[model samples]
Target chain A: MTSDAAPAAPTNPGLGALFVGFLTISIQAFGGVLPWARRVIVERRGWLSPAEFTDMLSLCQFLPGPNMINLAVALGVRFRGIPGAIAAFAGLIGVPMVIVLLLVTLYEGIGPSPAVDDTLGAIAAAAAGLMIATTAKIAEPFFRARDWRAILIAAIGFLAVGIFRWPLLWVLFVLAPLGVAAYWRWRR
Target chain B: MGAYGQLIAHFAVLSLLAVGGVPTVIPEMHRHAVDVAGWLSDTEFTNLFAIAQGAPGPNMTIVTLIGWHVTGLGGALVATAAFCVPCCVLTYFVFQLWNRWRDRPWRVAVQAGLSAVTIGIVAAGALVIAIAADTNLARFAITLATAALAWWTRLNPLWALGAAGVIGALGFA
Candidate 1:
């Protein structure tokens, strides 16, 4: 008896899985989603590896938009197909976007109050810490490359803005090309 | 054609300025809405900004708050949608080709450039807020202390916020 060989089918993540993952991440996206997104995909779901997660993050950062939304789309597509990408994008952006609108409702009625300034001052200060944290966290990986060119560029950029008090746009314009040259030099 | 349009334009700029995230541009938004446009006073802007931060989700919520203050719920809609559109569209295209050139040359350069710019903008925002936060020694203490606590604490940042609130109640900035 002769047995016929069959073509293998393409396996894909199910729609239900996409719905659950997207909704879950969206609802929980407080403060930030990067940490949680990494958790759910790498740890909980086992969909992407640690290396893959890091690559996705870098891509999100390199792009010109909300890193969180881009991440959800990229990872979702990897796991659950295009439908999943859409689901994740809508879920992540849609949920928080809506919440912002709703909160705006009550925000206007607070009226004139000095207490707001005090509280916002504190919050703003805390937000600064987060920015500092995010910067260090993102830069930590690049440190392993040990590229002195990058170090000089970063230092120059920092000095221009922090010390000389140059406008941000001007610094970016000058330093962006310098960064490109430095990265090219190091990579080559 | 009106003040509302001007407000939306301001938010659009802020949205684009949201380099790392939304909070980095909070000071700019406050400056524009309260200081430039005169839509709201500093007290009014600060109060709304605080509520927006204390609420939840991304810091972009300030756009909606400013919008609501300037106009109404409709203003809120305009601000939120306008702010999001640029980021969304830009990210979508980025997502489309993300896998192909994840490690391409310009990509690496842009990422490096962004790190420096993000730090600069965030620091700028912080400086602006610090100046505004100045009330007296007590308030200045809250600002410096909160920065230190945040740096040291492994605890969630909300704790720092709550602590600062108590400090604020004591007539600090």
Candidate 2:
């Protein structure tokens, strides 16, 4: 039951490769990073197969913190231990942070203009749309699997967090266990 | 003891609790930064979130904005490091154990369970952001159109965002 089978031989990307790859991903990903990360890692680099990328992404998603950041660490460690991980992490975040700070400073200086506000408003709305589309894509697998229990749990989660506006910590504590138990029992 | 220490401590706790990623902690962050610490106003928080979404890189860049708001460049650096390092360290250690347990039934169960929950959480986040962003009919239309275009086509999302921005600049949306 070795899960290490790569459809193709895995390329051992060095720390520099990891850094540059992630840096490119960071620069190109305007609204969200995931799509660019997928393109660069899975498609361009072929460092991991599609299935491997999905599995890694699922694990990263399951853990805490930002999914992409966790992904950088996990992917980095997979290739070259702590230094590789740091390379990837720094590549993913460092330049972007500088840019964000610079933008913030520029925005502060500009003050509030109705035209700028209108543009930001439009961008925000489009961003929201992008989020909704992302959610649909994420849910597609469950929809394909006909996993009613999983779907139910997700629905309950949405209702609790979105509609009821319950605190996320409470929602996770209550639902995560139940969801896990259901899957556990079903497997048995 | 000092502002940096307080900032580090605050974000370190948030770092661990950021399940489903940084967006999950938006409300808590707002409460602490705005309601309690009095670091930023409600409008500022909303604008920061919006700007982060528009900017390139990870969604968590909002942490940098928050930190910048609190204590300039030093605050931004401290906040981002505190929020990320602990979580990355945890992930680094856990990834080994997880790969070892790759064949475990419980692991499968946990993954399956959590994937569903993740979808739900992401959906909830989308709803929250949509509500926050769509203040008027035109804004709402842009949102719906962008979503529909993204969902139905293979076109890149950037195009939609650009179009929305153009519409806004033209005062159409």
Candidate 3:
């Protein structure tokens, strides 16, 4: 794992290459795109190391919009500037948007069959579990570093958002600065 | 404004407010689409969420579906672009700034702080979806089983999702 202290040298893929890379990632991803993205960018393309991918993902998660969308933009801009970012973003989302629209049309035609409802219900349940697992995976680094303060911050955040149903913006506003300050103090 | 115009304006604000990604805005999306705007019913909102989850690519496609419900193909395009473009531009500029200050102490602090908050936000997102979807005991079991499988094993999530779908189709869950 590469530490945040030192990042790997850039692979500097071209705009066309980024388009193709993201296109493949979008096609290959079924339920979730993040795992496939990691495989393609880190292992297959060598655009980023595992540690660098983790670092980038952390930033992407913090930003607004889809994490993968933010990732595509950041990676694209990193290599080839704004046009590169557009290429990556378009490749990532264009076809998938069409596919999703088609699926929605089909679903509407099918209407409310009990079997379809059941299938969708089970899928939703599983998706919820997948979200939980994703959270655990993202939190693995903190556990490994024994970062108790970070864990406490995460707990507070979960309580505020999940239990209390506080406005997300307010929760982030309150927790983010406090978290930053705490970590900074600990480092000092 | 027209429906298309309303969708663009509404989702554009949602685009920036999506802190931990699209799911974090589910409650707000529900509020707008179901309660405030009267565009979709409660059942429709939940169903759209499920459809987006089951579809390929990003789950944020729910926004596109909502736009489609409001108008048609053009609405889908408008909603998706409005929801994605602003944030993409922001990320592009921020990435340049981040790279320049990669080794700064405050950057490190910000990263650490934000990561923890992100985890919490995601967890909350999961909880919200679980409450909405797990309406029965069998569904709850499926959720728990899948979560355990994902956490304890290296199994592909698609396989778990498929198996659960089969169970549901069979009228078991």
Candidate 4:
């Protein structure tokens, strides 16, 4: 089955458009980048349809490294090959990388101060809350579907890495294959 | 190998293993950078993570900050590139092949399994950071409240973060 709904989708976003599109995403990505990336690529730019966006995102998520970075590369390559990949990657990372480094410099210059420590401490707590919310959102779908195998795998993962303080490499080595096999059998 | 080379090699391995994204590899990074390499204190590690989370951009910024902490600009550049390039290259080559096999039953199983495990790993990361961050009852309460707000509401999390900062400045949390 052909994937495209229509054979002649008129847009092959130029490298410049890819760069500028991702640049906008990077600048506005204060807490998380995915939503912004979706808004820009799927909605604002009309580069990928909603289904295509989800499909691309799932692929990016499945592959290793930072999902968003992989997303930029995949999208870039999908549109315009290796050079496009580089352009999208550079655009997505460039301005924000500089800003983050600058922040680090300023933070270093501040040295160790009580007020700064307090502020950072509180911020860290809130950031953790954000992470918790993120996990809940991701897990919600499986929970809703009563997917016990997935839930069990998740619980094992949490215990192994979160509570036991095990090395992640060993944990993944043991868990990944078993999880995959379990899922495969369950699907049959 | 030189420091940059070592950093690259270490992160390149981490890059591949970073299934689900940077957060999945964070505990490992923390273990190496803080516990193993002794590059930073526990406080510094968590603080830098907070800063990265607060700042604009992708979650990769935390990796960049860690590199910057270790060896200034050059380290940051090297670490970011090393973490990104190998995996991006892998994605570049694999995406087309993967799409062709979209209907494979094994592929679906793999995705489902990996995603569940990834969620679990991310949850573990949240617990690690929460323990590090919630030093007092007030701060702990703030974390719980923020979690609820973020989980249930459509509000942008930046607002919660800002309010938490304000509470900290006022010495309430």
Best by lDDT: 2
DockQ numbers for every candidate? 0.24, 0.55, 0.56, 0.49
Evaluate fnat for each of the predicted models and list the values in order. Answer: 0.24, 0.75, 0.72, 0.73
* RMSD of each candidate relative to the true structure: 9.1, 4.3, 4.1, 5.7
TM-score of chain B of 1: 0.61
lDDT of 3 by residue, B3-113 (tens): 988898899999998977786788898999899989999998887877777776787889988998889888888999899988887888788899899899989988877
Which 10-residue window of candidate 4 chain A scores lowest in summed lDDT?
Answer: A1-10
Q: Evaluate candidate 2 and give its CAPRI docking class based on DockQ.
A: medium
**Candidate 3 chain A least-lDDT 10 residues:** A1-10
Candidates 1 and 4, the one with greater DockQ: 4
Score each candidate by Cα lDDT: 0.58, 0.83, 0.81, 0.80
Order of candidate numbers by lDDT, starting with the best: 2, 3, 4, 1
In terms of docking quality, model 1 is acceptable
Instruction: Give the per-residue lDDT digits (tens) of candidate 4, residues A1-188.
Output: 12123334547899999899999989866556765675567545778875466557656766789989999999999889898999999999999999988887887788667786687678778877876766675566678889899899989999999999787667776887888899998889
The digit string of per-residue lDDT tens for model 1 on A21-50 reads 666665543334543464455444656654
Give the alpha carbon lDDT tens digit for every residue of B15-113 in model 1: 566655564466677777777788888887776666665554555666777777778778877887677767666666666675566668877665655
Going through the candidates in order, what is the number of backbone clashes in each? 1, 0, 0, 0
List candidate 2 segments past 4 Å from native. A1-14, A28-58, B27-50
Of the two candidates 2 and 3, the one with more favorable lDDT, higher being better, is: 2
Q: Candidates' TM-scores?
A: 0.63, 0.85, 0.82, 0.74
